[model samples]
Every structure is written in structure tokens, then in C-alpha cells.
Target: MLVFIDESGDPGFKVSKGSSPAFVLALVAFSDRAVSLEVQAAIDAVSKQLRVFPEFKFSKSRPEIRDAFFDAVLPFDFCIRAIAVQKERIQSGYLRSNKEAFYSFFVKSMLKFDNGLLKDARIVIDGSGERVFKQELSSYLRRHTEKGAIRSVRFSDSRNDRLVQLADMCTGAIARSYRDNRDDADRWRQMIKAKIEDVWDFR
Candidate 1:
């Protein structure tokens, strides 16, 4: 199995100071390698059509682009699994203060809590952030997750990794549903709702 993981929102507790109230960590998994390639070709076509120079990102793209992106990639077979955490619901001081700890814990939770779903899967995560953070997350997933559940984990630049970008777009759609201020919050996620296996609200 191939799993592409990406997150939307910062793992910060400063919600009152402009930080997002909720954070979403999502993974898009493909059980068949051929389907994965098909989706990659779809992404490539969308990129060419939209002239998305770097990569296709949900936040960076306009509504039309998002529409085109979802329209292009929705036909493929994939499973979306995600965890959305409301920071205010968290009481732990350590998790509240430590962003890395918070991110790693929930990521581990998302994969470990899977009831025999994931097995020996290769994971690819967005590596646009600090290299140290990616390196640590790679190790953390290996150590904290169930033994042999993850066959391998690697970091890839989102610019070059279209699959990771797909994960980002999926995560952005899930994160949008958690925001209270947006009127069209559920619109994007609903577009690809059929592909979603679960959107867990972590309490």
C-alpha cells in the first residue's frame, strides 16, 4: 500500500493570537499501485491546465482551480482518513506548549488506531517545513506506531511530490469543515466526500 500524508494548520495553541483553532492531519492511501499512477497522471494534467507553477495547493488556488482539481482527481480510487483536533479541547500542558509533540502524537494516533487497516505501507510526508521536524517525525512514526505497520517513511518536497500535494489538498478540505467563520466551509470536502473513509474529531 502507498500512503501520502500531509497536514493543514499549525500545531499551535495560540488560537487567540491568530493561530488556527483546529488542526488536521490527513492521509490518502492507495491500495493499488496502478491506481496511484493514474491519480498522479490526473494531478499532472490538472497542473498543466491550471499552470500551477510550483504545485497545486488548496489554500493557494482560487475557487475555480480547486473546482478543477477536485473535478480532475475525484474519479480515482483512494481512501481518505483524517483527524481534526480542536486545540481548545486539549488540556495537557505539554501538548499545548509543544507543537512537535502535539503533531507527532496525533499522527501516531491516526495510524495506530486503525483497526487492522494499515499494514507494511510506505508513507510519504510533506517536507517543505523544517528538515529536522521531518526527520524527527520519520523516526517518531517508526518507533511509536505498531510494529511492522509501516514499512517505510520518507520526506518529499511538496513542489516535486504531487501525491503529497494531493494529501495537502485533501487535508485542506477537511480543515475547512472545522472553521466556524467560513460560510462555504463544507463545500470543498463535500465535493470528494465519497472518497472519505473517515474524518475523526479527536477529543
Candidate 2:
């Protein structure tokens, strides 16, 4: 099993001039068919409700966005967790500007998974296109994780993307949610926190 997590928009203090939403944090969990069916079913139902078809995906050009049940949903559906960083916070300099600070925040967000759900499981993260950063992060995980059981960390740029595509969906869901209802943002954060606790005893 592999877990794919991602975020959309920058949490950086420098928000693009026209950007309304500043940042989003998202996490997605992936598994093989046998265990992924129920989650897939729920996702399909949701997609149908939203009428998102195949075209929703960027990989395929002119892809038709049919209901997952109408045709089929991605083999993997995500628990889909996310948080939107408030614009006021960014303008006020409450968040850090350095890249490491941004990444560390994501690490803490995703660590909600059971401490060791990642123990032996490989972790595939969407690459940031920076070899130096990737290498440094991989080494850091190895040094900090449990002896002989550290989960692998990887990055995938837009060119070679599958896991990243899925992560995109999770991030997109969060983006849409935040865009639609700012009030629910707090609830979304709480859901992520609760999910972290739910999986804490998973092992």
C-alpha cells in the first residue's frame, strides 16, 4: 500500500496578486483493490452527485467527466483531508517564508496517519522538481524514523505523474471546498485532526 499526499496553492507569505485562496493542505491514502472498494464506492457516489466526469482529470485531454458509477472511478478514492490557510494570516506574516518551514508544516499535517502506517509502506510524494530538496528530505526521514522501518519518500514531477494525479484530486477537493464555503474550513481542519486520531491506533 502507498499513501499519496499533496497541497495546492502556496502557503507562502507572498500570495500571487490575484489569488483569492492562499493555500490548501491535502492528504490521500491509497491501497490495492481488495481494500479500496468501499472507499472507491463512496467516492464514486460523490463524484456522481457533483457530476464530475472523466474530463475532470488533467492527464487526459478532452476527457469526459462521467460519474464514477456512470463509467468507473479511479481505482483509488481518498479519505481526502485538507486545510486552507487564511489570507489574513499570510499577510500578517504568521506563517514562515522559508521553504523548509512550509514543508515541515506539511509533514506535521500528514503525520496524522498512524505513526507506523508508513513503517514498511512506501510513501510516494509529488516531486517539487528540486533534486537537492528531495534528497535532503529523504535523508532526513531515514535519520528520524524507526530503526529499519523508515517509509520511503519520493517526488514526481508533472511529467511522470500517477500518484501525483491522485494527490491532485485530493487537493482539488479541498480547494473547491474552501472556495465554496469559508465557514466549513474549520470543520475541515478538525476532520483532519480526527482522522489522524482514527488511524493512530490502526496498527
Instruction: Score every model by TM-score.
Output: 0.95, 0.59
Query: On a 0 to 100 scale, what is the lDDT of residue 9 in model 2?
Result: 64
* Local accuracy by lDDT, each model: 0.89, 0.50
Q: Pick by lDDT: which candidate is best?
A: 1
Backbone collisions counted per model: 0, 10
Q: Which stretches of candidate 1 lie over 4 Å from their true place?
A: 128-132
Question: Mind giving the per-residue lDDT tens digits that candidate 2 earns over 73-93?
Answer: 334333544455665554323
**Could you give the C-alpha RMSD of every candidate to the true structure, in order shown?**
1.3, 7.2
lDDT of 1 by residue, 1-203 (tens): 99999999999887788898889999999999899999889999888887887898888888899899999989999999999998889999999998888888999999988767788999988875687888888898889888888999888889998899899999999899887788989999999899998888988
TM-score of 1: 0.95
Model 2 / residue 149 / CA error / Å: 6.8
What range of 10 consecutive residues in model 1 has the weakest lDDT sum? 125-134
